[model samples]
Target: MALIEYRFDNLRHDRIGSRGIDLQSLDRRSMEQAIAELRALASQKDITFPRLPEAPVEPIIARAAADRKDFSDLLVIGIGGSSLGARALLSSCTPGNPGCRVHVLENVDAHEFERIWSGLDPERTCVNVISKSGGTVETMANFLTVRQRLLDRFGVQGVRDRVRVTTDPESGILRAFAQEEGLVTLDVPPGVGGRFSVLSAVGLYPLAMAGLDVEALLAGAAAARDAALAPEAESNPAICFAAHQVALHDAGTRGLVFMPYATRLFDTALWFVQLWAESLGKVRRHADGHTENVGPTPIAALGANDQHSQLQLFMEGPADKCVLLLDVEERRDLRVPAVPAVLAGLQHLEGQSLDDIRAAELRGVRAALTEAGRPNATLSLKDTGARSMGALLMFLQCATGLAGSLLGVSSYDQPGVELAKRFAHGLLGHSDHAHLRAAADRAGQGKALTSVH
Candidate 1:
């Protein structure tokens, strides 16, 4: 595959000036060293990635694409990684192709559920309930609500066939329920986490249902894995990225934002956010066991959309943020001018093609962000397809792990999220009003909340 070259040198000075960081003399040598170490680790971990079966999954994917079932809609019930990865893949791949609608329900917002329920025909919709643990409160709740809706609309038989599950093997409430209820099932690998599961069945199944090329996607990921596992700093994209980002963080840049130019990539940014945050946000302890808070804060923004909204804050706000700009190199649909005579007078503007206009706009945005002193990096995709997307996802995941290692954090575990889960369970399982009252009191004290009392 041809490597997408970056014009980093052109933007480097402007980025440094904007962020007030002199990265000119930053040790690129250390980055090279870190890359070497990470490459070795990646090579050693064979168990990290298992070969996906070629036969059964391929047939299922084909069948799903062919059998448009009565379901005009699909509601994916999952939280965090389970939801974000698949949502990102689906959104980016299906721009303007509105054969069927895909909605993701990850939160317990009643209003959102109500809206979805009102719009969807339960008989005509398939609900993909995804939970690695099978007992995630938010996911299970959404599943139950949707299941009930199905029961009400299409009766028992419809519910049995329409509801599908993606989860671990022979464990969790979801797995058991899927078996007992005889719903269609997909196995989520035990070793994979939700954020790191885009190339797995968790993401592939949905993308397949949406008529995406899962084979191309997996091939892309495999290619990326090869590139990331290579030792050379100049050759290994993931390592180079990791080194550069870690060096930036050490230089006092703490805020990281992913800004994708296309609207489809907005959800991709969210998926990246979870992967970066869950991996890097940690308190590193010294040899003496003393710990310190040190991690990059991750944020996501849509390109032209946020260019109008949040670009102001990014440009004028604190000078501690690093931005990653994702640019798609090819667009399938191009809007052309009906006639060259539409815009006359201005010599430069007259007879300008739509593609020319779009190019100019994108260039202008990059130039503006660079001039504003934002340290921005760009990732260009040759085209938006399953292969390129899969490559991108795998590349980001490897880069994230390397970046975390450089920052001295365990990039695999998420202990903080477990705390929230525990607290939520306590509140839900117990009949004690004290805990609820305490939460309410805290909420009331916060200025953001509207208090009844």
Candidate 2:
């Protein structure tokens, strides 16, 4: 059986007619063009993550095994794309190791910094600092601080044993340090951007080190890539999905709701929020240099839980949102024994399991949203296992790439984020950015008073 499935049946486009996107019309208009764009991206050797699952990962696997034997705690340092995908996979698929806990420091904020360190015994923990260019400020800052602690406790040998660097193959500062210090290292692959690097060493090495089935995850992602690459517009889920959603965006749908029924899949939605927001939210276009505010806002919600919270506003507030629901089928279903009901009218739920209630609620919400004229779709996962999670991640990633193609935007580059990085680097005393430092100093003078209230 296929490990995952994608369907638009709940979209009710036939009944909604013009309000919901007509896929046939979308196919007639832009299917070939979108496929070509996606194919062009796939052909680029620099962007190899689409095929990363099938690539050699033995080096990552071997090092992970070695690290597993040596350390009782693991810490990963990075920000944004560098850490989100890895964090999501670790939380979703890996059971907590009673002996070794994993911590990902994606923030340098004081509270976040203290919280991560407070839980760890510095002597036994291993730190994997990841950044593609080896120049990311937050990552390097965390690495330097943690590196001194490891050196103080275990000396230079401990620093070499406990620290691993994942970065560019030959050129980056991290790679240079690894060569000089005899530290184990993994390449982040040449063209893979941070947001698109989950399948690369950025994610796989940490997963392997934590004793998860990374091979199975990659196999699942490979299967999804093959499915997404299918040439036919109607048959290829990724292309078809992008066409539909982009059409909705054209029709003024500004918000995207990702509501998952399973607790384990919550991080998956959070990961997508970054992927979609950073990839598609853009100012420039490949078509005639068109510049206008564009892109869909991704909103995350959990089923049964968020139904009581965000659904009210989502259903009744505006006509400008679309909802994607994730329904997970568990491999092992627990049954509830017949028991006395707590309330007089609630006897009907006495013997039904919690999963059954969640499933029923999914159906109810879908029906309600459909009747309210809200455009909605559902992604059903076979199980909450690694393969299923892997397939889901790949499906959305391909869809993001395809959507960028349709919009004529460069999905891989994040220009807005880079400007902020430059400003922060200047403020942090980069010699090449004196002007930036002066402007930041000016900007900070009046900003402090804003915080007083």
lDDT of 2 at 77: 93
lDDT of 1 by residue, 353-444 (tens): 55456556667767776877777777888766877887788888888877876777878788878756655665676454336546644654
Model 1 alpha-carbon drift over 4 Å, by segment:
1-7, 10-56, 59-71, 94-100, 153-157, 331-347, 353-355, 430-453
TM-score of 1: 0.85
Which pairs of residues have clashing backbones in candidate 2?
Answer: none
Candidate 2 local lDDT, 241-360, one digit each (tens) = 787788899888888899998887888889999999999998754457657767889999999899999999888998888899888776445666665656677677776878998899
Q: Measured by TM-score, how close is model 2 to the native structure?
A: 0.93
TM per candidate comes to 0.85, 0.93
Query: What CA root-mean-square deviation does each model show from the true structure?
Result: 4.0, 2.5
